[model samples]
Target: MPAYTPPLADFTFLVKDWLKIDALYQSLGLEEFDAELALEVIEQGGKFATDVVAPLNREGDEQGCKLSNGQVVTPDGFAAAYQSYVDNGWNAMLGDIEYGGQGLPYSMAVPVHEMLNSANLSWRLTTMLTESAVLAVTKHASDELKAQYLEKLVSGQWTGTMNLTEPQAGSDLSLLSTKAEPNDDGSYKITGSKIFITAGDHDWTENIVHMVLARLPDAPAGVKGISLFLVPKFLLNDNGNPGERNALAPSALEKKMGIKASPTCVMNFDGAKGWLVGEPHCGLACMFTMMNDARFQVGLEGLGASEASFQGALTYARERLQSRAPQGVQQPDDKADAIVYQPDIARMLLTQKALTEGNRALAMLYAKYMDIAHNSSDEAHDNAEAILQFLTPICKAFMTDTGLESTSLGIQIFGGHGYIREWGMEQLMRDVRIAMLYEGTNGIQSLDLIGRKLTRDRGDMLGITRNAFAELVAGMASGEAQQHASALLDEWYQTSLQVKAFSAVDAAGGACDYLAYSGYCLLGVLWYSMADCAAQGDNPVLAAGKQKTCDFYIQRLLPRTAAHKAALLESADTLLAVEGSEFDYL
Candidate 1:
């Protein structure tokens, strides 16, 4: 495994040059969070991730988590690292100031999280879920509930978990069987078992706040009847501190392939005291506030792992002596030239670089919209919201899908070394593998994009993407950027309209391919913008790298959209024609 050096330069390029954070803050009335401050945060976060958290990655994986009795014990040094994470105020960076948070824009937290995820993903999982939980509680919880939980949660004195899955229900909440009975003291007694809960039980904090989804008695059946509840590991006492243990505990720990350091628990809540976060039957809506944030963060999870694997593979490729280059013997003094001289290796590395960097830009841009949606009072706020809703699925699905690709490329670059755990490439693959499945699987996300975002809005949201590309094309100085942007925009408009006209079955069948097409197109436009910025910037080396990567993306990867588009145009009849029993040859 190679040492994790945060991609500080790329982060700076995106935040400072491409996105123009300073100007953005001024426009959005967030004067306190300038580009300079953002850079400072990234630098310090990188240091913490490298110095404190990274060294524990391999050890944590080897040791994993230990479950004895009803409690879960994290790897050695995890608790201390988490405490340092709290002491350094990393946890509260994006929390509201009213909740003892610094009240910074969520964009500022993006790079820091990426660094953390790169350095040590297992340790980062708990914190990631905690932040998502905080968002849900902040948005929907009552004032009294906020007063009790916000301070500790924002301060990182306690952790959080999202408990939504059960034995019978996964992505489909309509099948949920958990019961929340109303109590006399205005609380609800929650009873049911929830599975696949991330960081469900941990020792890093004194208490864990679980945002659970359950059904209320007398409520309508199905997803509409589901309600959100705040179930704590420990009930609060008069002093506002953890006191009695709640009637909830981890019944079993999931034995997983990766992220072993993070506890994925089967939690059983037996008559646990909980309070409703929102109106009855509105739980799914409230939970989306958390799920949406988690989905984006999950996308970042894939990006981070991809980055780590890329760094390791690149390091190995450069130093490891191998056969001579096809062109010539680059390292005559050695037994053979380094594998870095191989053209195929270059392709793999460049592919990883383009995907990782492009996704970084996409994620950061999405974060900026999040800021605008939160801070602005004008039409920009509404537009930002629309864009966020429209891009959420793309960010989650595309980034992770490509993330898996990038990580697998890392393994291929490493050859046999990548297949083993010693090089860390396999672990990276295993860890990111789950991202495409959880937080609403990539399949689910694609359906949401084409269904809720497109059909529900009558393709109105398609204009957001179209308009953005048009604006980029109008401002682009380089001929290449203009050409690519223009062509992609035209195709995007046509494909979007075609998909919008798709019958429900056709749309459902084509959703995944459409999402892939959208992702590739979106990245193409963003790559052009990044290349344009770098081309006009002061750094020659960075400019050259960006230009070449952009060229690779445009020439090589952009062709993928054609295949996806073709698949999208295909009807579902072929798929539906196949009888279920006809495939039972096995």
Candidate 2:
């Protein structure tokens, strides 16, 4: 297994310099936080991730999780690691203080999460879902339900799962068949099966809270009838302790690629007692409160995976001897110079580094905007919310897509050795593949971006985003970086107009490409911002290195946006013209 190291320098740079989160906290009346306290938290969080959770990653992958007699048993050390995680109060880092949480800003928690994800994604999933559940219950659940469940969930003595997908209703919630019958006592009995539930059934905690979506009788048809429910694995007793077992079980587990340690279960709920959360016929809106968080965290998963892959590949390239340098025999003492001297290897490594670092900055800003949108009372809150709404799909889709690419590059760097299990390169790829598929697929995210976000209110959100990017570009010093930023902003503005026009005719055909185009341009802006920050910093080596990476990104990667733009302009007829009968080459 590859040794995992927390990228403390990169994280600190982002938090302390790039986002200036201390000022943000102060502006938001978060007087208790400062740079020192935030760094100390990050350091301790890094230690926990590095010392405890990381070692279990390969072991968990090898052992996987088991479903025995309807109970899901995670791999060895998982339960203990989880215990350590909760004992240190890491789970409550971003929760509300009223719910026994730390009430820290989301920006402060994001880096800790990134480190956790990089160390062990499977292990991270348990808490990730729990946090999302916390968000949902806090936002939409009844105050009584909150009184009963929120404290335990925020404390991490229990875990949570979002039960959305069904066997028949893949992405179409309108076709959901889950039934919720009202009881005389004002509770409901939920009866249905939900598939692809992460952390659905686990032994790490005494209880598992499931945020379920079900339909009520005598309600309108389609998604409008769906309602959110808080269903627990163990029904609460009169004293509020876990009492009788609920009528739910993990009927089976999905055995497939990636994150094997995390149980993706086929859950069966046979008249399980549950409480209604939020208003009737408004479950989809309530559930979205949680899904948005999940989507962003999933994007962080991509960033985390990419960071891990880059570290592994960089370490291997520096130590693994292969061909000599093209210019000269720099390492004549050995059989040949390390692979790091090779141009192609350097290119691959640089690509990974560029994407990882650029996305890291983007993720930080995303979290910063989230904090402002949620916590701030300033006038910027509305703009932040609009920008966040426009950027969420891009963040989730682009980051995960790049994660798959970066991990694949890790395997490619290892060559045949990468294919072997012992090298641990393949596991990263497998684990990251699910990110692209879950929390709504990248395709669906793109549709949301183009069809909904871009076109809604006649491009108001896009205007907010473009104006934000323009301000960032205005801060850049005159040179190649400034030039690149200017070009990217212009391209983004022009492309949005083009996509808006195209959507009038056919949106689906261009949605995916438009998203990719927008993502690349957005990352270009972030890279420019990083380069600008580095240029003004005191650290010579770090600044120089960042400048080089920024240049490479601008010169090499930013041009890909042009290709996506061209593709986005293509008519939908090209895709729709193909008949079902014509695809039968097999």
Candidate 3:
């Protein structure tokens, strides 16, 4: 196995050159953040990820987590690593300053998070969940709730988990059967058993806060009756420290194919004392505040896995001796020749590089808008919010799908060795598999993209995307990037019209393909812009690599859009031709 090297140079290129962090700061009227400070954060974050987190990944996977006597014990060294993370103020980076946080923009956290995920994704889950939980609390929680919980969570002395799934509910919250009754002291008694809760119980923190969803006694039926609650593992004392144990315990740990280090627990709440975080009968809206953030973070997770697998594959390709290249022996001094010289090996590596870099660019693009939506003035806010809504599902589904493809290619490049455990490529594939299933499965994301964001809004959100792409194309110098951008804009316009004509059944049938179409088009635009940026810069090698990757995306990957488009335009008659009962004929 190879070491996990942080993509520091690529992060620098994306933040400083591609995304133009300095100008973005100036435009948003943020005087505090400049390119210098951003680079510094990336540098220090890279060091921590490489030094502290990466070393624990393989061991954590091997040791996994053990449930002994009702308490979950994380793998050896996991506790020390987490303590170091908290002591170093890493968890406080993106938290609100009002609650002992540093108040940094989400854009600043993007690269740092990528490094962490690449270094150790299983270990990174707890940290990621805590940050998302903080966002939900900051946005919806009352002052009293914030004062009691925000400081501890932000400082990483406590961790947080989202409790939305029950054995019966899964993604359909309307089926939830949890009960919450009003208490005498202005709290609620929550009695529900939540399953598949990530980081539900961990020993790294002094306490755990659960953002739960349950139904009130007087609430209406279905999802409309759901309400969000804050259920703490230990009740806070008068002095603001953990006092008594709440009526909650992990009944069993879920055995899984990957991310075994991150405990997925079955939490039984026997009248657990809880408090509502948002208005009554509006739990879904409040939980979405956290879910949206989690969705984007899951996209980042995909990007990280893609990078890690690519690096591993690239390392192997450069050293593993195999048959000679078709043309001739590229390395005559070796026993045969490095596989990196072979055309097929080169192609796989190039595809991985293109997808990984393009996905990083796309994620930063989303993060930029996230900062704008949160901090900008009225007009900017509306536009940014629209873009965020439009991109959320695409980012989650497309990135992970393509990311899975990239990692699988990594395995293919390694041949039989890739399937072996010590090579580590297989583990990367296993871990990344969960991203597509969780945080609203990729299929669910596609439905949200087409049904809610596109057709429901009558293409208003897509029009926002079109205008941005047009403006991007118009400003570029006449070249391949210019041509690619114009072509994508034209295809997107035609495709949107076809999408508008989709019937309900047809839209559902083609949602995944339509999402892929949109994601490919979006990446085309991003790659062109990135290529243009590199061409005008001083680094010739980097510039050449960027241009070649852009070309590869155009020739090899962009063509995938046509097939997706065909699927999107096709009628759902054939899809419905087969009855649901036939699916289980085997």
RMSD of each: 1.1, 1.2, 1.2
The collision pairs in model 1 are none
**lDDT (10s digit) by residue, model 2, range 319-374:** 99987899788799999999988888888999999999988888888888888887
Find the 10 residues in a row with the least total lDDT in model 3. Answer: 472-481
- How many collisions per candidate? 0, 0, 0
Count clashing residue pairs in model 3: 0
RMSD of 1: 1.1
State every prediction's TM-score relative to the real structure.
0.98, 0.98, 0.98
Cα distance off (Å), candidate 1, residue 370:
0.8
Per-residue alpha-carbon lDDT of candidate 3 for residues 7-58, written as tens digits (9 for 90 to 100): 8778888888877889999888889999889888989999999999988988
lDDT per residue, candidate 1, 1-586, as tens digits? 5689989999899888888899889998887779999999999999999999999988888998888989999999999999999998999999998889998887889999988988888999899999999999999999999999998999999999999999989988899999999999999999999999999998888899999999998879888899999999999999999999999999889999888888999999999999999898899999999999999999998899889988998999999898899999998899999999999999999999999999999899889889999998678887888889999999999989998999999999989988988877888888888899999999999999999898667666788757756776777788866886888878888888878888999999999999999999989998988899898889999999999999999999999998999989999898788786777854
Q: Please estimate how well model 2 matches the true structure, expressed as its whole-model Cα lDDT.
A: 0.90
- In terms of lDDT, the best-performing candidate is 1
Candidate 1 CA-lDDT value? 0.91
Give Cα distance to truth, residue 481, candidate 3, Å.
2.6
